[model samples]
Target: MCILFVALEAHPEYPLIICANRDEFHHRPTEAAHFWPKQNRLLAGKDLEAGGTWLGVNQNGLIAGLTNIRDPELIQSDMKSRGELVLKALINDGIDESWLARYSPFYNPFNLLYGDEKALYCFDSRAKRLNQLTAGFHSISNGALDDIWPKMSRGTQAIQAHITNNSNPCIDSLLAIMKDGTQAPDADLPQTGVSLEWERHLSSIYIQHQEYGTRSTSIILKDKRGKVQFSEVRYDGKGRNLGRNDFSF
Candidate 1:
């Protein structure tokens, strides 16, 4: 997941709300969100190339999502896939900080958000820090948790406003916010070592590109009653909708 907006206990009706967009190369093989055949309790989209998921939730209300840190200088071609972290987190009882501390170096720098409905935490692999998220609005992108990048700020505000105004926010409404394609002004863009042109292309909440862009948007909502709803909408290289999947348990 390239960007994720989370509202933990910030909504009156829902205690947990997550809206995220996964950006990647258009040609990578993927599967839509579903109950994994080998792990039926897990629901998430699969990255076929790496055999892991970018985001997933299990039957116990445990949730996990990942985003790569945007420093190209730190990338290692042979590093392990960061996607596997999400799988390990969902299946485990809870995040084992010591275990993660020991193994994080094998993977590229990343931000892993993992927790159950009662609590949420974000582990910054680059800094080797674990943050226990308080009850409030939070946004995580290619930077540390709640960094003020333009796109991050814009998306965080958008979701906060939507939830504050609507007592009963719908899935389509939340998904629409994630569809925003407004790019940040050139002066407002962060210098993340990418070419200016490439930075501009990725400055929006919803990226539009033929090669690398947002391939899917996922929304997860858990109400006060402990019921959960998971939804995903897929897109192609040209930014056209392919299909959608929705599940509740």
Candidate 2:
């Protein structure tokens, strides 16, 4: 996923709330979020081209999401796809410090978040570091954890408001916030080695570019009773809504 705003144990009824937008090249092949045909324990969208997933959650309440670090110089086409990291975490018991240290060097630079029902962990391949997240709200985009990008900040605030004000959070409101396409002011944009035009285009939470932009938006909510709801809205190359998928566990 490209942008993620998560609230962990921030509500009495809901223990996990996630609002994320997955950005990808419009032409890349993908399938909507669902239980894998054979591996039914895992629920996630499939990157058909790479045979891996950008995010996923298993029946045991283990969740994982990934975002590529924005460093064009470090990216290598021949390296392994970062989506494998999500699959690895979903099937494995857990990724510890030593596990991260041993395997991270082989993959392209990335930021990965994975954990079980009680705790969460973050690993950045570029930094070769791992951290456990405490309870509360947090955001991550194509940068370091909690990077002050306009979209990430606004998304966090939106999620926090939903959790604090309403006992039963409205999924539509969260989806609307994730659909926000507002660009930050010129002076506020971060210089991530991209042209001003490209930077402005990518600043919005919901990007709309012809070749590369947000391909789908997903909202996942998990209650304390072990009920999980996942909803995803797919978009086409021109930003047209293709379809939506909703699954529960």
lDDT of each prediction vs. the true structure? 0.93, 0.87
Error of 2 at 144 (Å): 0.6
Alpha-carbon RMSD, each predicted model: 0.8, 1.1
In candidate 2, how many Å is residue 230 off?
Answer: 0.7
Candidate 2 structure quality by residue, lDDT tens digits, 1-249 = 789888988999998888889999988999889899788889999999989999888988888999988888887777888898899898774667788788877777888999855888888778888877778998989989989998889888878987899989988888888989999999999888789999999999999999999999998899999898888898876778999888888
> Looking at model 2, which ten-residue stretch has the lowest summed lDDT?
91-100
Which stretches in model 2 have alpha-carbon errors above 4 Å? none
Give per-residue CA lDDT, model 1, range 11-64, as digits (tens).
988999999999999999999999998898899999999999999999998899
* lDDT (C-alpha) at residue 120 in model 2: 86
TM-score of each: 0.98, 0.97
Q: Pairs clashing in candidate 2?
A: none
